[model samples]
Target: MANEYYEFFCPVKMVAGFKALEHIPFELSSHDASRPLIITDRGVRGVGLVDIVTKALEAADMQAIDIFDDVPPDSSMITVATIAALYREKECDSILAIGGGSVIDTAKGVNILVSEGGDDLRAYSGTGVVKSPLNPFFVIPTTAGTGSETTNVSVIKDDKTGAKVPFVSPFLLPDAAILDPRMTLSLPPKITAATGMDALTHAVESFTGLAKNPISDAYATAAMKKIVTHLPEVLKNPSDAAGRLQLAEASTMAGIAFSNSMVGMVHSLGHSVGAKCHVPHGLCMSILMPHVLEFNLSVSSENIGELLLHVAGSDVYASTPVAERPAKAIATIIALKEEMYALCELPRKLSETGSVKETDLEDIARMALDDGSMLLNPIDATFEQALSVLKKAF
Candidate 1:
């Protein structure tokens, strides 16, 4: 049996719906942060989503002091320092990040530098290294994955060493998370599928991992059901506003779930593969989820079995035998991947991702063993086991 003692924490005030972007100015004013620095990437700016945020802020008579839209897909320590310098140069009082995970993570890093008054990002690299209150921050994620808007962690890559350093502190949590469907409506089909699967991976891992608690389980299950129902719905009907909103909300719920309970081997391996192969995080997550599920099924069969009801529907659950439900649940996830692939070429195998090479399996497995997320896996994985899973996944 899993340990009975556990704790949950998610302090983000989420404003979700079709036009939730409009409420950002009010939320910022509540924190007395009118001169906000808008942080984002060029991808978001290219789609004019930042314009939507700026227009809304203007309508509320609270325009941003400056907009930094040069954030890269992998947030670097140098980018964080540059953003902090810009924050100070612009005389900004708060941060309003408008993009995906990297943008939000960069904004969090900037907050750490701006509020704590330091140029050395290495000082706040480890878990809980930040002890002071951060500047007021809000996040508007244009992607339906990553849930970085609600999590209390930020990953900043070291430019000099190419190492990813994690920073964990409650201060990293945003004061508010705005989930507006308009922000994500223009996301490409491939990106939409990958991000949705990333959210599903988060839900599944958080639900079945060793640190699972009642509160986290509740959020995870809810997130799983929503993803199963809405992911395909939005895929079939890209303009389905309600479906997009549901996916976004599910992503946030999954973020809250994993943020509290933590993730497991899927994340460990995904992070390693992503770093080593330069594969997109969500694409790596989407491909590796089923393999991780099978690896963990021996220890978490009952929990995995319960997810069948959510993923495959009630009729399938009612007809399947209890003893066979876990395997069926794992199949359901694979089937989900196949269906997504049919819709938008979501890579089911690592080989299809174009970046992962055959010879990289050993190095990837070694990195997986070093990942902190591995500690929370339902079953401890040996070097041989991790390598076997990687080869099988390959």
Candidate 2:
């Protein structure tokens, strides 16, 4: 194992199943949260799940002091400040984030200000900057991707700079996470595919990146196997409770893996594209994953080959020389992405998305170079390399 050193740091008490939302009140009680601010987006509120959650809290004798449902897809610092003001006004002692990454990141951002009384969120930009723990925060992810519920990082955009800043702090990790399959039942098929692919991206990147460790590799391998087996089934039948549960578990495991070890070029490029071009985060991830894997194969082939064997139960490594493993792994990932796209009827290329342009390649490459996630890449990427990867996607 080459003296493998691993650090596992998921602090969230994850409760996942069919009726997971019904148990949140008890989880809140364990954290001594009497008054919680439920943070979600307007879309969630429109779906009426917010009312169901409110009733559950009421049943558990926990007061829902405020419900902030103003979060947008790519949440901004202004939105975080607005939610923080509301949190203070309501005198809420805890946060219940109940939606996708945007809602969870918004809750994490609001927690920073509500706990520390800061007007500017950019003050705590770097890792481990928060000295004190935030309020009792519980993350209930509505989607089966992003793993924001179990991560120590929260991504929020700064409107002034148009830069996506990640707030990395142990304090930002949710104290509890509820992963009910029912919460994901209402997700559209496109969302299911995108988020599932996002989870797959996390596992693949974590396993193949420079920071791979035995523990994270174990989690990533398990997540990859489960996702590869179950994602197609879940897409075929979204209401299949068993399939949904497996997908949710896979997403959680992938989140834990990537949060500790971090993701690579796919995320770097995805984050840049999402920030600049206004593409959905998961969609960008899905579009760029195959190309990024191909680009990373030269340096990351051995790790990727092992992961491929784990996911597909095929020892392409043993059949081929070590020199050929990377190319084989890259080809495997490309094939898997094509299969997923066919199964889910999703777009396979950046050109299929109709949002990106051949002209945007330079800007995307520059932004990706500046992305924090790029540091974890197995190989140092040149602007030309990034441009080539983007071109392949396009």
Candidate 3:
């Protein structure tokens, strides 16, 4: 029986295709914006994506007012301050964030500061604190991993404290998201694998978590199927533009799915580990997904079993019994991880990440208790339970 109550909202307009980058200026102008401040990172610049965006802006006769490309792997409050100051100093009226998760997160943090005119970002750190709309913000993701282009949340680190601050509000959603295949064409295989795995985790957690609804389930199912088909294609042929676009679409869909439905213990554990050990979020999720899947199977087996049809394809799904499909789904994920490892050396266990240690497990487990995403986990996870999962992952 369907539930009588549910809610879903996704207002961000998306332009997706081969040369979706060319529509940036048009989209900005439709919002009555010019003088955009382009935010990115050195990695994007190294791949010539900045130049590509610049050319697109030029061709549209709406060149960016300035560019901020010093974003780190983890966004910092200091960087947000600098980007905001520059945006104001240059009189930039819009924001065009280009790059992966961190760069888009940095841009979101900058938008909060510039639009809210705030000195301390930590003051707005919790969920739904942003009462007003942000600037004319648009995102062009250079990697098809984080789906930050479509998400309503941003994670920025307090450089001094080394603590991650999450900002969530409907206002934080980008005005538009552009998914251009050219942007991710140069992404290396290992990064491609990690990011694709991240999208899969987002989809899986959203579907089986406590807040599952029809809209979110639709997006999550589509995302899972896309990952099953296109992720491996991109991993096999890194230069496949069509595969890259499909993966990007999947990531965006997964982001929207998880944004509305919320995530679960996988994100809770992944976030804690990344914060404590400096492991990349996607890598942590990739290593921990099967473990968390197995843990949640007790409560979410039916959901996971149904999802097996999408993740494992027809033959495997048809051969597996309904009662046993959950285990098959988990096996499929483990096999996917092994495939990634064979192709690009994606870590299958936490110990293989080279940053996670036995001593760090206790701290990560403790931190997991504080993560807000854990609130939506179908099964409550105590510190001992979290630690046990971490040990198994290790």
Winning model by TM-score: 1
* Tens digits of per-residue lDDT for model 1, 68-101: 9999988999999999999999899999999999
TM-score of 2: 0.92
Clashing pairs in 2: none
Compared with the true structure, all predictions reach lDDT values of: 0.91, 0.84, 0.90
Q: Could you estimate the TM-score for every candidate? A: 0.97, 0.92, 0.95
Q: Model 1 residue 207 lDDT?
A: 90
The numbered model that scores best in lDDT is 1
Q: Per-residue lDDT tens digits of candidate 3, residues 1-394?
A: 7655778999989899978998988998988998999999888888798999899989988899998889988899999999899999999999999988888888888999999987789988889999999889999988777878777889899998987888998888899999999998998898889889999999999899889899999999999999989988888888899999999999999999998898999999998998889888888889999898888888889998988987988898999889999999999999999999999999889899999889999999999999988999988899999999999999
lDDT of 2 at 98: 88
Ranking by TM-score: 1, 3, 2
**What tens-digit string does per-residue lDDT give for candidate 2 at 87-164?**
888788899998988898888998998998878999989888898988899888888888888888888999999978
Q: What is the TM-score of candidate 1?
A: 0.97
